[model samples]
Target: MNHPLTDVTRTLGGIAYGGDYNPEQWPREVWREDVRLMREAGVNLVTVGVFSWSRIQPRPGTYDWSLLDEVLDLLHAHGIAVDLATATAAPPPWFTRQHPDARPVTASGTRLAHGSRQVFCPSSPAYAEAADALVTALAARYGDHPALVVWHVHNEWGNHNALCYCDTSADAFRSWLRERYKNLDALNDVWGTDFWSQRYGDWEEIDPPRDTTAFRNPGQELDYHRFCSDALLTRHRAETTILRRIAPRVPITTNVMGTLEKKVDGYAFAAECDLVSVDHYLPAADPDGHIDLALNADLARGMARGRPWLLMEHSTSAVNWQPVNVAKQPGEMRRNSLAHLARGADGLMFFQWRQSRVGAEKWHSAMLPHAGTEGRVWKEAKALGAELAALREVTGSRVHGDVAMLFDWHTWWALELQARPSDQTRYLDAVRDWYEALWTLNITCDLVPPDADLTGYRAVVAPSLYLLSDHDADNLSRYVDQGGHLAVGCFSGVVDEYDRVHLGGNPGALREVLGLVADEYLPLRTQDHALLEDGTRVRQWVERVETRGCTPVLRFADTTDGGPAHGGPAVTRHSFGRGTAWYTATRLPVTALREVLRTLCAQAGAHPVVDAPPGLEAVRRTGEEHAYLFLINHTLDTAHVSVTGVGVAGAEITDGRVVVPPGDVVVVREDLTIAPA
Candidate 1:
């Protein structure tokens, strides 16, 4: 299937190598220099009007498009394209003052102030009308501009005020429940409201899960999250409808904060966009953060269904938000950009084109820093643009993965609720632990939703899946029965969609396929650890399992009380149909988990593109005519990797045994060969 932005000539022409450009913040004289410097840096695209709502529409039903018109015309004259934004990210102060109900209210009943962005209540009818008007005006004015290529809808949704408990939201929540349940009786039954006299007598009695003395109903909280996601999506769809009508040829999208922010569902939002775009910010202090960044990129690619997506926003150096803002070390910026391209990003862009002299994010890095072209950041930025220009052949390629990892927003929300088996059970940490192990083996993976098609993957890993719907559970069983390897972590398959415990056994729905039924949970306190059969210690949580027809992969060697669990199975493997299912009863240490994953991949007939050392990543992107291999080294030490599977004649191999220095990238291309039978 071809994406809306698949036409390379219309889209960036090569790799989009620019970022957010705020020409309105500077004087008209400065705008000319900005364009001149953009050419020197090889910038081809810039995102404009992201936060200019107050400037463009200062009053009710009034707009001044002179500034935007000058900006777009200037960019076009300099051969730069524009990703025009609707500028509806934040409402103007006049609108909020006129309609105070548009301000979002916290769960504690305090209305959020209007100074920050995204302060409007999603359910407010007045806010919707004003937002639609702004988008309509922008689209109608700039729809036929020669520079306009893509339409950027509102900025990051649910970034600040994800959930609101105002009366407007309460009414909308009730209406949503009515559509879902159709009656108060069904709602009461599904929420399991009988325990605390919380059964609703009417739809009006239902409220957004607000601040309370005790824990609120898990089911209700989960539904509130869903409602908030849908509410924002409704606003997006409204704006998209106007853009499609006015500029039917341009693709519409909104930048998503993937894995960085948890309030929005990426898959649901991606479905609404003509193309998926993500913003990723790596931690400055953590040396191992590149792995997490890779995970986020993979998630964004999966949201786009393996189609090429855009890297919307990333800092050129230190950001102002963290406690200690450390600048990017030498060579880190280039390696980071290539990593995203290797994963599946079609374009590379940063947060800002020029540094802001006054603002909350004044210190945030930009393509052109305050120090100008003399700085290291500017040098690196120019060098990267040149490299991307040389590698334009990589455009319109796709990356394929042999392994799939489950990433569900519902599971993340339900697992991290107020109550749980252990306080140390973090959903993302568990998923990353498994992903880090796979990365260590140089394997590529795709982050998939539970209900996504499983036929493409040879093995699937699910970690901390606390909430499972009936459809998802049945889908997993069928995948395993049809000869696919399945690996699950502890605290999985424990509850249904309504947050009610599966009563028959722990991991209730998957017990038959896993060949083990857990009877009770054994949570470890801080500083506590238990010994596994391999002499590696497991911590945080453990479960007591009784195998039905499974082979013990590892057993518990030590227990808290020296009880029945001391000799029980800590990990089990079962044969289901022509496939195998493996289960871990606790979180294994990193070294041990890596060993186990290596064995699992071998058993599943899954191999990496190359056998490289730790901190070196290998990924393959293939086109119909040729294939490219990307080897990136994240560590400070030099890496020497041997390449394989490229023996076809006339293949252009950069280096058979590539020598990648610290924080560097190596790309190798091979021509496709036709096999004769």
Candidate 2:
């Protein structure tokens, strides 16, 4: 909620650099060596006790603080900050032995054995009561610890206990429903439970929404996903409440896995966190991985708004979890990390300070990789740290940009409710498809939520807009009617907040302004494309609609199954008040799609930061002192870049617009004092 400043003021910088380091995981003598190496590498902070529930508690209440106390004192003595953990994610074996109901039940109805983290059920009052007591004890114990900057609540929640459906969960779900609907009648009407001859006169009659018979409703499945997210948030809120009473100023956060679908609701959780942090892991040559990373960073940046985000954890070399544990090439880590910085990042830390000796993640790479500090990975870490330390100001200073992309959740929820075409058209995929297109153009943009003001934007692309509030609809209408350039893909403006489809045809809410009707849709599964009057589409068949009062800019290539048309307006524009609204009837391939976005952006008065060579990537960061341009080539082959001077007032820092060799990262900050001539 901090808004734009969070992105700029915070800067793509790191204050407390380092990751989780637990000397307790190793021998006493090694702790000294670890501290020495940390100082040598310019490590500023370390996160400790993430999965140490058993370590801290030992045996249910015995309280062995000897090792933990020493570790904390040791790290603090070395001038290293710490992100102290609550250690409540994993329960002591004795607690579960005494209370069996505390075990987490999975979606497939299997019980999670003890020893796994996040095995405690969120709905269990006993579990909450235990977790609350432990968290309070930890906060009260370390409430004034100087080395600690924040409290890391429950580790990576929703991994194990995500879809809990135990008795406690069932009861909690019923309570949550009562609070949400206030009564059973409303719930029945919204869920359409009446149609199945299943009328719940009382709340207890409703069980968890699951497949009891052969018929599996996707709507119910989607709601269950949403409910689970809410449930985890409820737990986070409860735990953070207790901690807040004692340590009010210290931020409370958890390392969130980027784009977790059926787990914690990160957007909602944003309300609780003082600063948002996320885990980032990208594949070496993943076809969609790069774009996926962009979406993830944009999503996290959106959550943080005007504040800087934390790169909580990423593989230094290669993570052991993926199907293939590919090592990061010589420059991949620096390149990818800088890419994260270009977006918006405040801090960088890995999962563990030292690799785990035991557990599922024992093999994950760390600063102190399995090869000690003598290997290439550790050497790179040292170099990265040095670069950050020397360039701290630019690293911390804010970047300025005005344009923002309009991102909406209701639209995401409503897209799946599309009555036609096919039920498989996903909302995020549609949004990602559009976002990736824009990204390829090297244009600077912010991924803003729907509620954000659209007036500042020159162009706004809202893909797969499913549900819109009356006010939101009005805002977009005026934005378009008043000279703003707007673009949205198919499956937009179909529903309201109650998850009800708009009564009219497709885009029922904005049909008047958009000036089009999509009576039929052609689902194209192939990556082939076709051009119409307006623009060409990249994915599957296009929307076949009648150009009512507006104009038909394009047509379909062919018809399907006796349909009159196969394609309708692969792209179209309609003037409202003084502006325009554009709709894309078909999914556009990334290359063609960026061309479309580039055209719209040009119309909106926003141009690419700079043209680059084939493999080179360009991103611009504007500051009061000077504007910084980051050019990086992630590919193996060298790429050439062409550039006119970046608009800077002072000393022209141009090394000639030339080819940036492969795997090269170029940083140029204009010296504003020099005369333009």
| lDDT, candidate 2, 348-388, per-residue tens | 78766777777788878888887777788888888877766
Question: In candidate 1, which residue pairs clash?
Answer: none
Candidate 2's TM-score reads 0.90
TM, every model: 0.97, 0.90
Q: What lDDT does each candidate get? A: 0.87, 0.70
Q: What lDDT tens digits, residue by residue, belong to model 1 across residues 194-257?
A: 9799988988888899999999998999999999999998998999999999889888889988
Off by over 4 Å in 2: 1-14, 216-222, 260-262, 284-288, 399-402, 406-424, 467-471, 525-541, 558-564, 637-659, 671-677
Tell me the lDDT of candidate 2. 0.70
Give Cα distance to truth, residue 170, candidate 2, Å: 1.6
